[model samples]
Target: MPIANQNLFNQSRSFYLVSILELWQRFSYYGLQCILPLYFVWQLELTLADAFRLFSTYVALAFGFISVGRWLGEQILGIKRTLLLGSLLMMAGYVLLVLSTHKNGLIYFGLATISVGNGLFKTNPVALLSDIYNRTRFTLYHTLACLGSITAIILTPWVAHHYDWNIAFSLGVFGMFLVIIHLIFGKHYLNQYGTLTDQQPVSLKVGLLVSAIITAAIVFSSFLLHHQTAAPWILVVLFIANILFYWQKLINLKSAMRRKMMIVFILLLMVFVFFTLYLQIPTSLNFFAIHHVSHQVMGISFLPEQFQALNPIWIVITAPMLAALYNRLGNYLPIPHKLAIGMVLCSSSFLVLPWGATFSDSSGFISAHWLILSYALHSIGHPSISALGLIIVNRMVPAELKNFTTSMCFFTFAAAALTAGKVATQTIAPLYANSPYISLALYSEWFMKIGIVTAVIAVLMVISAPLIHRVMQSNQP
Candidate 1:
């Protein structure tokens, strides 16, 4: 058996290189996201629903196509080339976004490029790191990603407000350029992780042919699905396909494996609900904060995007404590039970928003503390569900199928993004259109409804914990 390597904690040079590169990539991505919603609504003149739909689609496809990127890296471009391509494509996407300030048709095309580029770039570095260290440093990667997001949320909006939107986006483009330069210089560290001689390789001709066909198909689909109304149906079709594919995979497992797979499936459902609720942070929740929350907190005026920093800042501050708690509680509680607690906390986060909304004064400015508290609640739940979900996937899935299973797990998030978009369209879009400047009462009602529905999901997760525990016991490693 190959011995497991554990050098990640040692802070090796290669590790720092990859981590820094990954951090910059995340910085560029989230920096844009910090301003993307307002850009769509304010600059593009899109309705709330349309903006959210496009955002949802962008997020869904960015993550959903990671599997495709992995395949292309392994089979055709190799990891180094794929990474290079991703950086270029993402930079191009940012440039197009800036140009979209003038020409609108470039918006979707830009989003599509960024989505594909992110998928290709994000995970491959981790894969290389895994090969180098002989272990996965998922948490470290996640922490850095969150830190990047925090920095972006704190700075990007301030830049856009003080300077210009194009300048803010140009900053993102510059970051990507730095990433490309770093990767090109430091790429030798990743050479050993590239396609191996033992692995079956695709012919270049065949790979190019396949890529062309896929591109053609995507173009045709975009043409057909040009209407905003058609976006949800596309998501529905994709969701159904993912479900059917997962079911087919489950059929071939032995009885024990099947039970474990079922538990994984159940856990994935809980996570889907969690993400559906959590994503409001970037979409509807941010809008609410900008419109309703007091700009002056303790007599200091802050940008709306800075509000997003709360959740990540909380996560960073509390992560070590949470890690220690997890270690102390190791196997004392079932994973399902721990996840149930997370779901409950997530539900409570939403539930708290309504109460916060109640604090709005006659001028419609509510204390930012309520939103801060909501973010804190969400930060607690975020790791509980997300981190544990990944750990559970690694532990429960069969060795040979781990990568495939993990891809499918990410697919759940894509579905959740789409679902969240649909929810926003139904709940938030109408309110924004009717009120233009939303009232405290409408905000409270909207928060209450989502909170109630999410609470029901939390309840379901709690009730199912025992059953999942029972199945999990039979498949314990």
Candidate 2:
């Protein structure tokens, strides 16, 4: 009984410590992201297309490499050293970004460093957290991290708009160092956890060779795409590779696990589509808000970047209401059907954007009300797709493949980030570039096309929901 109590105390202590570190880390990351597109266009003097591609690549790479980082943490550096290295690398990246205000090469190098660092920092800490706490306590970590991201999005633009870019990047540097300080003091608690004995530690020679190859690859890719549009193609190739890999995995698994995995994959693809539309908040929609939406609400001036907060803000507000609503509905509304309903809601939000676009004035500045409604709809619709997707994936994935499946789930976000970037550049950016403010007709037309596609996807999801429910029911132990 005493031993169990000690274990619980250890877990509670480490979870709080880890949560703080994770929160600040996300704050640093999202702070950079909230203003990254604007920085590229306004400061770096890049075209909208170039800016979108670069931002997409950065976000995609940052997320996509998390699986690799997890493997490295477990196999090469172990949990403790990997976390330390990742924090230092992140700090270095921010320093380089701060320097990029004076020079361009620093920008890419800094981004690459941050990409690798974030990939490492993001996953390894979760592993450590899991070591201390059971699945039920996991939500606390995610919820806190979400709050950090939300806070960053809200505050970063305010800082950057009021101050300067260097100060903004410096905020990230400060946050990264805080993570280091917290870990340094708290390592004793975490050190007793998350050891993998089967995997051999990476040797110095192998590490050097791998580092050289990665550095060379980064340099080559940067040089190759320095003056071109390769981001979309890269994402497409990755999606295809993922599809093939999953297909092979499906063939190898037992029938019950295989069916469940296949359903999860389908659901993930739908999520990819949903985010391709949803994540535009940070890229295309952000630019749209800045250029075309009115800055004043009831005669009060506001920064354009502040609108990005609507997503997370609304999520926090509406998620409980949604959970309550779903609970009231009970088992009558199965998970798959609820997911389908969410997809439909998401599609409706896109459609709402185009409808609101028609109300823009001659100045092409739409009322803040329209953007507000669109965001509100998105807030409601997003949980249906994203939050539900996470829940369903958790329930569906077999125990043995949980980690790998979860890693694949992260990959979906990476793919969505890349897809969102492509959609923003190819579909949305062109309409806004030629005019001082994008016209109401242009806005309507642009979103109308996207709305139609998502609507079709939603309808398909509705059709399949029952079958998915049946499969899940049959497959359960």
Q: Which number leads on lDDT? A: 2
Model 2: lDDT to the true structure: 0.77
- Summed over model 2, clashes come to 0
Q: In model 2, where do residues sit more than 4 Å from their true spots? A: 1-11, 197-228, 231-235, 254-256, 324-330, 398-404, 427-438
* Model 2 agreement with the true structure over 1-477: per-residue lDDT tens digits: 011223343546667878888988988998898899899889889888878888887877787768767776777667767777788878888999888874667788788788878877887877777677665565456667768878888788888888998888898998898999998997766655765722356788977965774466446444423533665567568667877877887788878878888899898888888877876888878888887889888898889888887777777677777777888898899988988887777777768877766777777778887787788877788867876888788888878777777778778888788778778875453443666444445556767888788889889889999998888888544
Question: Residue 367 deviation, candidate 1, in Å?
Answer: 0.6
Q: List the residue pairs that clash in candidate 2.
A: none
Please identify model 1 stretches exceeding 4 Å from their true place.
1-9, 134-137, 194-207, 210-226, 429-438
**Which candidate number has the best TM-score?**
1
What are the per-model C-alpha RMSD values against the true structure?
A: 3.3, 3.5
